[model samples]
Target chain A: MNKSSAPRQSLGELLPKLVVAPTFVVAVIFIYGFMLMNAWLSFSSSRMLPKYDWAGFIQYEKLFANDRWWVAAENLFIFGVLFIVICLLLGLFMAIFLDQKIRAEGAIRTIYLYPMALSFIVTGTAWKWILNPELGIQRLVREMGFESFTFDWLVNTDMAIYTVVIAGVWQSSGFVMALCLAGLRGVDDNIIKAAKVDGASMPLIYRKIIIPGLRPVFFSAFIILTHIAIKSFDLIIALTGGGPGFATDVPATFMYTFSFTRGQIGLGSAASMMMLMAVIAIIVPYLYSELREKNNEH
Target chain B: MNIKRVLIYSILGFAALIYLLPLVVMVITSLKDLDEIRSGTLLSMPQALNFDSWDKAWGAACTGVSCEGLKGYFWNSVLIVVPAVIISTVIGALNGYVLTKWKFRGSTLFFGMLLIGTMIPFQVVLLPMARMLGFLGLAGTTSGLIMVHIIYGLAFTTLFFRNYYISIPSELVNAARIDGAGFWMIFHRIILPLSIPIIVVSVIWQFTQIWNDFLFGVVYSSGDSQPITVALNNLVNTSTGVKEYNVDMAAAIIAALPTLFVYIVAGKYFVKGLTAGAVKG
Candidate 1:
């Protein structure tokens, strides 16, 4: 009986490991393994297909020197900053407004939040029509006796990136609103009452106490928005096709076009590495803080 | 006070209009005939309610060499999403079960690694994945896309189930074990039965994500196996023919309809899943 039970006991102990092994293997190979291959490809002189020859940062050199790459990098900076800032402000305002115990809060909140459920592809295509000079808002307004009115940012190279920011904010501001609302609801009611009793204005209360207390929500929103901004591909693709001539290409789109279409695999891999670095820069700090907080709780 | 209430309501109503305008335009344009779309205002109601555009967008619109609308791509999404969601969710549940209930040395470390996987940009994995898929003879196949999604999706599904199962009491598992139930038995009988809510949340979340995904669809799948998002994009951006704004809008709506329906029906669980994923992250 003891001999028979020994192997069965061992199998019992191994079952969990067996169950988890596939995910573990996938995580190792697909995630970490691919990441390392990307790093390797970035350093090699690969084009059209990945080559293993050591190239010593030639791709990085070319990427930095390339004007289109510079445009993409600059576009990312503009889109990232404006998208995060606008979404945070708009989301916070909406959250605070809704938190005023207003009637029809549920309906209004749903209206704002519904876009979050839609894909960026859909968001982009819809906004594309709306922003089109001839077929959309511009034409509508032009026919509305406002003949000189112009809002043709979609096709305007200088203004196309801002169009992306606009669509992005529309899709995500509700999410930010939801996050801030959750933070607002968690605020101590007594404190707000105390401020009210002290004859503080509502704006003053919000500025001094409420906003200050929601710092963590702000942090969380910023991190989430930053990453979204970085990985923004489909929106730009559908809305502008990074267009009026690649004026709105962010790093993600740049990577795709170069690696897949342009056959500059080495350059594309380099861009991908830069994107990965940007993500890691944001994520590592966020994870460290999160894990530290959890450890403290434990 | 009355003025304040009116001001707030008016502002909110205006904001709501702005939010609804694009969707309204999409629907209106989708209903209008091509000539009316050309002459009439974009915001105007269609002169004649036309369902032909919807029919065209679904079955007759051309993408590349195929004139079949988004129908095939839609089914491709369904095939890819259903199996991927089920398999990934089951794996996630199992991983969550073991990580929490059958805790071992370095389990937290493994969980941390998985969490890190969630944060890594998919771009990092793109080239390597394409190459890897090619090596496995799965490149440009639906199975390849499904595999890619499952691999990427495991991080999220695992995160969801792990966080949820952590809240489940361990005493139940302890009792089951003492009653001579083994690992798989306890999981199937005790844990899986208790996991319905999280499973729903996981399914809804995964379904929406995989359905909406464009990057992997465009990159991995090719020919007729392309998912709807990619096909819709191709149809919209094709640039060769006269721009069929109506067909494009209809196709966009068709591509968006599944997730939209899911959201409208089970929005509560969707919000729960979003908050659980976001707040914890």
Candidate 2:
């Protein structure tokens, strides 16, 4: 064999090298790098200053002991479940209804989606005013000669969290509807025709056939919505500030209160860490299912 | 598309009105004077339409020492959101490119890590990220807020771009390689051009995320550096001061104008952008 014609091993070697090396470098430096740094800070006696002295799970211990932390965690579960389920059902309903080839579909679709365009701050304040008992719907209805109609949920201790859920669902469901609408549009009309030929009612066909087929789309929407609800701070902060005496408090608000409002850095970090853990606990399983489903499809 | 369809649309139309009721109230309230807002129904039209509250909200509303309305905070928001959006999206693109084209050892682990980053609530990262910013001597500054946005924005943007790139054929990367293009060159020349839809998506998402941010802005900025969200919160959420409902509504509208404008102007694109990687992949 001629020496030069030994087929240039450089190309083959460089292929993996070029593709692999830079990726490893960037991921290590940027993604996991910051995460590890955060994890390390959680372990230290760091407050305003990040001293690397080992606190040995002291922060984690205190995190569980805190009442506010517990409340925040509890609120997360409530808010997450309520928001996700409502948005999913409402989104699916809208998607299914809109898929019925109704007139003015485009205009109606835009109307639904307009809320996602506004920031949470806008949504929060707008809804806050609309829900305010003294100035909003309750007051409006009462003044209209109905003395018994009360919609004071935004201000009520027990009901404030539900108000957050309501606003949240309103703000996000349109986008979810859009997502499901795209998925619905992707469904083959032949499937619907087949169901019709088999004497299935529209609602029955949707429950039996269309829904089963839209699993991947529904899962995608669920993952996105759940993540959104987990990381929810803006809507809660803007709407209630976790207030009416911590009634609407979630992990985000709890972390914020300790970290910024009270200036209890160590306790704040503990709350923060707990929140991170809770979110991961919620997200990991769903993500695993989604990933597994994708692999199975392939 | 007959009488039955017409009835269905009428029901949807009514539902759409209910969905828009709060916003309609906000707009109607924005147009009314303090007196009308105090006495008149929110859904009802103003007795005399007035722009005085809007004028005050945009320029004359007091937030601390500044009597200037939300317009004063406008530049600060621009200062924060512009750099925050651009930097975060660029990093997202790079991460997406690397994750897709360069499948290395531990790439799955790294991707998993990014997904975890997305899942972790901002509340959880609040203290540590704040402390980290303070340690870097960047806390309570515009730059600090931008850094926070970048970190928070990273996971979602990366997810967006990664899903988007998945739709493009792997051969694109191989072809770029065969042409002897470098990583940045391939991304800029090939991937970026095809990424307009996703880029729009990220931009819209980031704009809403950063612009609407309250807790981060509140904790990370003070006085002159406060973004409009914080200022608007203060204006409406005064601890003891009389709540001016008209001004507050006006302030909220003013704060939201920029993002809302972008949405309306690019309304078609905004809707499409959100649904881009949602289904086909």
Candidate 3:
């Protein structure tokens, strides 16, 4: 818009070459360029090889018809919703509780927030062991003289999705807590003082005043977690391998199996494109609103 | 009213316990004998504490012809991860700095592409990535894996630094430019020092991601070049004659220890790093 300054600003035209060129080149060629290649592969009759031969919609058809693909789609939805909701609730509660002027707050905060540092490779396997029917909670309860104990969700096809949800919530809720807690910190202390003057109950104050104030942070947390849910592979692969007969399968793993293990590159690419579309559909609107909100704040 | 405070503390404590329970189980199972692990409760004390499984996991578990444990791939992971972290984070920081400070035309679109790269699941891009790597003669090597990590790590690292950079006053860069400092000079001296918090965050995030990555390792590495996660996967995932529960648990713990250490040590920074963008921003 400032056309008069355009030539003057070009005085530094060569500056970006030092830093920007390397980043731009890598990002474009390796990332976007490869992505285009992937999209092309999806449309071709490739199978464990680079078959540039044309084969439109065939891969897509197979991708849609595959039971595993359908299961993965369903699993993504179930896990995504559950993971987002529970993480939000737990994160909010932790943030609010930590906001209270409590003793040992720093230490407790660290304990609540440590999980985000560890990768799912570790946490997922730990969860797998902990949720194992024979080695984990079920057996632990049985030894306590509760012989009727049976919490084998990891092995149960119908309930394996919940197992993924549990581990997911555990891993991510801490990060969400940190976000909400920071938002809580940013909340003007005056508002709380005003609430106290009005004799608002703690729960009422949190529910009405704090929660609403924290909505943007909450939304950001939700969006990030939703993306994580959609792209969840490490946890599923590590803990269950989409196992107990593909009960906990997700799109990410489906993509992997088709592309690598099963040697169905075209189908895998098609499945991935579908997953990409799903992610874009969900993310674009949420991100637009979030950015708009930021603009409004500024 | 006094009791309610106790109740709140208790609830928080209980929640923390739930979160920590699995980690406790993992450590315990690693120390237990197979018989004890088989019959023992997950939360139960080991009948006899043993280091055998740890030794076995580190040095004795077999993948094919070799019975050497995760130690073989340990160096491979390190070699791959260190460079991958440094390269990606450095590039990411530069990307962040240029995008936010420069704000050239189409900068937002460029950023949009970077973010899109992050959101697209890695597996979705695996087939083409494999082909590309194969064509480049980098497939199934440490270089290939490092390339993958850098590409994947770009989005998040850029995100971390960009959000942090935006928080800095623009006047700093302007003033530096007035002093005739070039991009690299300003970035290296001024911007990087100021970015300690976020750099720590970026390093930790990238380290854990690269360290724990299994899919990339499996697809991009072979033979002695496989990272620990791939070895760990092969060890635990492929059940043959009889599953060695103790060794498996020990191997899992071994595979996870580095990241676990990062969490326990930099736990505060980790949360701070992640929440820095959403909460602090």
Candidate 4:
């Protein structure tokens, strides 16, 4: 609406470029620049504060030799695998059952999907209460006459990680159900009908004819879930505080603990770099094929 | 056939309870006193529908060293989220317009770089970003946190808009160009009028994310500038005091209310935003 500023042809040509330049520069510096800084910090002898001097492979060596890092890595495997598999299986079953000619589908779907909307902090807090041995399910069980019932995973070092898995599954499995439902809606009706005509049962039709067609949905779900699993800091902090003696420390919490809380910036940087590598290892291929597919379709 | 139908409904009902229990427990537990919480079961109803814990969690309970509860931190989140969401959405719309309608040479590569920004684990960037904030003398300030959110949030906002604007045919822009429309003029007249849906998606996504964020809030900001998520975590995990589960649950629910409200209201857009960016964390 300003009078003379708009009609200039040169200004029009330059304005779009100018508009985007700041964000572009920011992306380059903050995203790329910060990553380079971490990589450099990892290789340097950074302790309390960041030092730019090179001390090659020392942090990585320390990281590898650390028992806590190994525990975190092993925890990531157990957490990641169980989280993904349980979510997929539970999500698939829920989606299939809901896809039937069911009543109140919208209401039920909202109940299942509402957890996705809550912060992981909230999820963790609620679960922390639910899993607390003295105040939670174990006490409730004992009150109900099961005198020796012991569901004390919250304080149990060996089983504390699975409490995390339970909470993780509770928070995330619903999203998987949403994804599978979308995929199910996209399934060709004629194919399912033909399979039915051939006397294939419903489960057989889903397993043999339908579920395999859902690989793309499964792929997208897998990538998102894995990324969430890797970047999971808040939930672990809220639920476990990486505690019961750091038994539930994943890479995210591990990085936070060393770099900020403990002031071992070098070790923390290494942990962060490993996390970045895990994301890259998963994402590079995902992005490559994703972008390629988009291009092919366009 | 009847058995199969019964089985499906029962399974669904059971699954719904699993998802609903924690939320119900959170609300009920927040309404109960320490005595009631101790005496009754986890799922027990409160004695008298007490407002004691809610008042304490909102106004009096300790978060870090402050006796002021989640009310201050709640405002901090609102202040930060409002500016960050608006600024990121506007910039994202402009960037999307250029990347799609005004495709200059090498813009694709530029967009690719921005896309990569979305996937970089935040842990990798924490040290440098913190130092960068200190260097700029913005550490421990709300403005610095806003800047950080806008920067990281740009990638997802851009992705949402670009994917949306691409579905807009370019011939409309070409026609407007022939009628002597300039860049901002065309954007004001054409693209903006058509961008309401994607703008909803971007705003909802951004609002929910920034409101719920703890990583940047915990690391970069300190003292009074901490967001509600950080404050809630500190309040719940504080080692000194006797654990007040009622106050803790109340604070958690308070921290969760905004996003849950948005999800209940414009949940179609929320779900659209989630499915729209599969790459989003």
Candidate 5:
């Protein structure tokens, strides 16, 4: 604290503050200020352009009343739950298997994670074809003599959101695997050895002890996966275009449609405010708990 | 024991194939002509290696109103990404230095607010930022888009650097200050040389993110100024005389190549970058 201040002011003392000021201002205006601006617009009568008059919560009322918004919200819940769950299962399975000192681990890990490097647009493009019933697996399987093959979820209204989940899981599961693998490495080897010496089967030990201890890793994976699911605009846009009559529209896409294309600026703003609330609802508590734990430690 | 080992290997092999399938399908699809793509299954090889679609996708394919290929947009992405990554990274380094080394009153609070920026859904900022860009006369231009990237990107880049810089013992900075070395001088002389690993981490993270960005590109830029991700989406979605799946696949590959190259070349740092980013606490 003494070094951070000086008896007499020096250029060195003020320079650090000066260097950080621009970013501070940008963060204020862009992040926090923009959030406030969006909230204000949600309450205003803005439609084509932002207007400055309050209109109560009519936009939110409209959002709640609209069937499209409900479908989008429902789709987000389905996608988020499915994506997070499957990624955890598959990623944990792979990390556990790979932790067995597998052969060519680097090559296999690279293969698993390469999808994460590609843009969602690219993943969506590839999966759009791969999931196409006419040209993809359905046709191939029919050719292979399963004449009753009908894997057309890409076009099916009830199943279109699942395709997004497929691509989402494809792109992100490896990250969970990486995090889990790191967690696995950090597990106290002596504890595992003692468990083994006690004649505990490996599966039982993992189920009862090891996997339970990896809760924090799984929680981190959930937060990231939820973020990805909420921000899932490009995947849905590029893959299905939220079609089969808005069947696969998630909140982000719904907000974009209502706000930008449909000129329902107030509706979009309200939808965005909902999204902001959802993020804060999830993240704030986790961050607060983490902050409190750190304070207790000190 | 033998059965268990076999089960593990077979499952691992199957998972690897699942992971490898889409990429393989993408490459194989790009090399085939339209007829071959229609006639062949995803597993079938091209009758002959053909790069015509790649040629068309690179130079002649139409994306809605434009007849030019993804070349202009690829360069547009390059133009936006290089400067945005460098500027954000440098500013982040300075901010990280100040927040950690030159801690002042309320710096922790400032960092807390800054950390919140990282979690913000860009949707919350879209309308306001769009209006801001219009006011600044940068609307529908690459420069405006670059500024947006830098601003949104600050939280991430700063987080990475700040987390990295905290490990540097403060005694070094204090000694330098006592010797009349100013803030910038100590940073250049003492701090920056230690920042290479983290700089690699930051650059790779930012480059991957900004390059793959579709939301900002779509919302901020218009027409020719749009980045490759947006352009690729448009190129695929535009319905015309034929769907031209080959060309679409080729264009997707091109949009993906730069980041894929970075990943293959510096995968260690790429993973490290993600791990560093996950530590938002």
Candidate 6:
């Protein structure tokens, strides 16, 4: 009986491992494996279809020289900086404002956050119409006797990317607000009371005490916003279609157009590698700190 | 103090209006005739309420070669979202159960690897994924889309379940093990029963994500197999004839309605999931 049961005990231990094995293997192959494959494709001389023949730095050379790629990268820079800054400031303000024991907070919070529930596709399309010169705000303002009031950023080459930023902030600031609100709620009330007892005004207390304590929230929000900004594809597609003529193109759309539509897989892969590098640059330090924190706690 | 009260309420009210403005325009435009949409400003109330665009957007709108509106793509979204959500959540729960309760060697390392999966951009995988899907003969199919979502979603679902299960007392598992409960037995009889809340959270979260996903849908699925988002984009951007703003608005609303419904109905769970996911990260 003891001998028969020995295999059963071992099998019990093995059962859990076996259950976890498929996910582990799939994650390894699909996620990590594809990442390496993308890196390889970026180096190969593949166009129209993937090829395995290695040609060092050729694709990256073309990627850097390509004007459209540069536009995409530039738009990403402008969009990323503005989107992150505006969302953070607005979100922090909203969170701080709502934290003032206001009434109807739930209803107001829901309204603000509803956009985050909608797809960027929906947000983009809605904004596309709202910013269209003839159909939307500009027309309304003109009818209201402001004939020179022109807000046609959706169609302008230089201003199209800013429109993307506006829609993005509209969609995401509420989410940032929610994050900051959670962080603010986590703060000890005693600290604020102590500051008050020391004769610090509300604004000063917030500036010195409350805001400083929300550093982790700001970091996490930055990480999330940066990820969204880099991966922005659908919004650009729906809102500007990366036009008047590819003016608002970001790397994701640039990659899609080249690799899939124009059949420049090598250059597309190179561009994607840059995106992956950007993500890794942001995420690795975050993961390192997160995991180290866990280790120290243990 | 009174002025402060007025200022706070006014600012909150303005923010709320800004957020609601687009949605209101979308709904009103969807209900207006094409002529009204063309003639009136976006802020104007419709002269006559009409559901013609909604009907057309639902049943007759052309997207590429298909003129079947968004109904087919909506169903396609449902098919992809349901399976992907269930499979990922179940796998996540199982993995979480083992990682937390069973505690095998290298489990944390495995988890850390999974966390890395969450951060990488989906673009990095598109080339290989397209090739692999073709190799597996699942390319441009709903099943391929489902597989993609599940693979990407695993990290998140796993994180949710693993974090939740960590708080469960492990002595129960020990007691079950001592009482001759085997691995599957303990999981089925003990762990899963206590997982209803996390399961709800995971399902709602995954459903919204997969439903709202446009990148994977556009990349992986083709033709009639397209999800609502891609279909909506194609419908709105086709530009073959005169552009119909009303139809476009209607289709956008249709595409957005499912996740919007989920948000309205189960908003508490939605916020909880978002905060939990963000805080844990």
**What is each predicted model's overall lDDT from 0 to 1?**
0.91, 0.78, 0.82, 0.91, 0.91, 0.92
Q: Give the chain B TM-score for each candidate.
A: 0.96, 0.91, 0.91, 0.97, 0.98, 0.97
How many residue pairs collide in each prediction? 0, 1, 0, 0, 0, 0
Separate DockQ for every predicted complex: 0.78, 0.43, 0.60, 0.78, 0.84, 0.84
Q: Which stretches of model 3 miss by more than 4 angstroms?
A: A1-12, B276-281
Whole-structure CA lDDT of model 1 = 0.91
> For model 4, how does the per-residue alpha-carbon lDDT over A93-160 read when each residue is reduced to its tens digit?
99999999889998999898888888888899999998999889888888999999999998988998
Deviation in Å, model 5, residue B7 alpha carbon: 2.0
The sequence of per-residue lDDT tens digits that candidate 2 reaches over residues A233-270 is 87887788888888888877776676666756666666
Residue-level lDDT of model 6, residues B1-281, one tens digit each, is: 69998899899899999999999999998989878877888888998879899999999999988898999999999999999999999999999998899998899999989988878889999999999999999999999999999999999999999999999999998998889888889889998899998998999999989999999999899997999999999998887788889999999999999999999998888987887677674
Ranking the candidates on DockQ from highest down gives 6, 5, 4, 1, 3, 2
lDDT of 4 by residue, B1-281 (tens): 69989999999999999899999999999999999999988987998999898999999998878888889999999989999999999999899999999988888898989988877789999999999999999999999999999999999999999889988999999999999887888889999999999999999999988988989999988999888899999889776557899999999999999999999999889888888877332
Better of 2 and 6 by lDDT: 6
The TM-scores, one per candidate, come to 0.97, 0.88, 0.93, 0.97, 0.97, 0.97
TM-score of chain A of 4: 0.94
Q: Write one digit per residue (lDDT tens) for candidate 1, span A1-298.
A: 4545667878788778888989999999999989999999999999987998899999999999999989999999999999999999999988988888888888888889888888889999999988889878899999999999999899898999999999999999988998899899999999999999999999999999999999989988888899889999999999999999999999999999999999999999999999999998898898789879879998
Which docking band does candidate 2 fall into?
A: acceptable
* Segments of candidate 4 deviating more than 4 angstroms: A1-10, A291-298, B279-281
Q: Compare candidates 4 and 6 on DockQ and give the better one.
A: 6
Best by lDDT: 6
Taking the tens digit of each residue's C-alpha lDDT, what string does model 5 give over B1-281?
A: 58988999899899999999998888899999999988989888998999999999999899878979899999999999999999999999999999899999889999999988888789999999999999999999999999999999999999999999999999999999889888779999999999999999999999999999999999899998999999999899888898898899999999999999999999989988887788565
Question: What C-alpha lDDT, on a 0 to 100 scale, does residue A216 get in candidate 3?
Answer: 83
Interface RMSD to the true structure, each candidate: 1.1, 3.5, 2.2, 1.0, 0.8, 0.9
Query: Model 4: how far is B99 from its true place, Å?
Result: 1.2
- Report fnat for all candidates as fractions from 0 to 1: 0.71, 0.50, 0.68, 0.78, 0.79, 0.79
